[model samples]
Target: MGIHDLPHALAVHLFFTLSSVVIGLVLGVTLGILLSRKPKLSNVVLPILSVFNTVPGIVFIGLLLLIWGMEAITVLVALGIYATFPILKNTYAGLISVNPQYIEAAKGCGMSQTQQLFRVELPLALPTIIGGLRMSTVYTVSWAVLASMIGQGGLGEFIYAGISANDNGLILLGAIPAAVLAFVLGSLVDLLQTYTVPKGLRKRGSTK
Candidate 1:
């Protein structure tokens, strides 16, 4: 791959990473909320998720490829599911970890279950939730490279090509950008937490 191929590859990589992470965030957080409300269900469900989470990304993608026949949806579904585990686990943890007193206070103030969750629980959980999002984003970037294996296109084209030719330049072309992409995306999540997390919670999270 030439330098000219870099932009398109980067764009494709970003597309896979961002799109999958967004899908995972929505699915994870939604399931997490439901699971938090049902602790017994969470106990059963979370362990199952953990088992799936241990599957290697390449193996997962390859399994998906067999079922879907190298479609972009295969890549998206694989990466998206891989991205979901951390977010789902953390969201459940964060929500359950919210102070019981706050729940009582919200109840005393006439907040409904939904109101208490949106107004208090989610806000308090923002820091932990964001932490999971950061992990998902960074991880998905690396996993997105597998797209090239299926010919869906990403920086992985450069990486795999480099490996075939033993060309370090080509490998660096992909590796550097991927590393930078992960760092940049991870930092954006941190910045998001700074603004979205409550000040007191941010301080407390920082201390921990």
Candidate 2:
């Protein structure tokens, strides 16, 4: 493959990564919030999510293929599952880690539950929540490449094709770009955390 083909492969990787991360973040954050409000439910739900996290990525891919066949949905579902745990776990931690004093003060001021969540808790938890999203993005991007095994082209296609053809240059072409992409994206997440986090929280090293 030429340098021109590299962009196409990179686009595939980006598409899968972005799709899976968005879906995973929405589901994970929503579930995390719901679970945080109901600790008893978390007792049952967190463990299941933890198990999903523990499952090997390759095995998860195999399971997806078995259920969904060798389709794009298999790759999307597998990547989404892989991306879910970090966001969910981090969101829960962030919510639970909120200062009881602040919550109590909000309650004393007669803030409604919705107001407390939107105005106080979520703002305070924003940094940690973003941290989870960063982790999920990195993980999703890296793994989405593997979807090429099922004919969904990405950087992994280059790596796999290179291996089959015994072309080190081709492998390096794919590998180097992927690593660079991950670094750039991770840095962007850090930049976002730096700017979006509250000033006091940023000072405490929680944001940056």
Global lDDT for candidate 1? 0.92
Which pairs in model 2 have colliding backbones?
Answer: none
The TM-score that candidate 2 achieves is 0.94
Q: What TM-score against the true fold does each predicted structure earn?
A: 0.97, 0.94
Worst 10 residues of 1 by lDDT: 199-208
Residue 71: error of model 2 in Å? Answer: 2.3
What TM-score does structure 1 among the candidates reach? 0.97
CA-lDDT, candidates in order: 0.92, 0.87
Q: Which has the greatest TM-score?
A: 1
Taking the tens digit of each residue's C-alpha lDDT, what string does model 1 give over 67-170?
99989999999999988888998899999988888889999999999999999989888788899999999999999999999999999999999999999999
Per-residue lDDT for 71-157 in model 2, tens only? 989998889878888998888889888989999999999999999998888888898899999999988888987898888889998
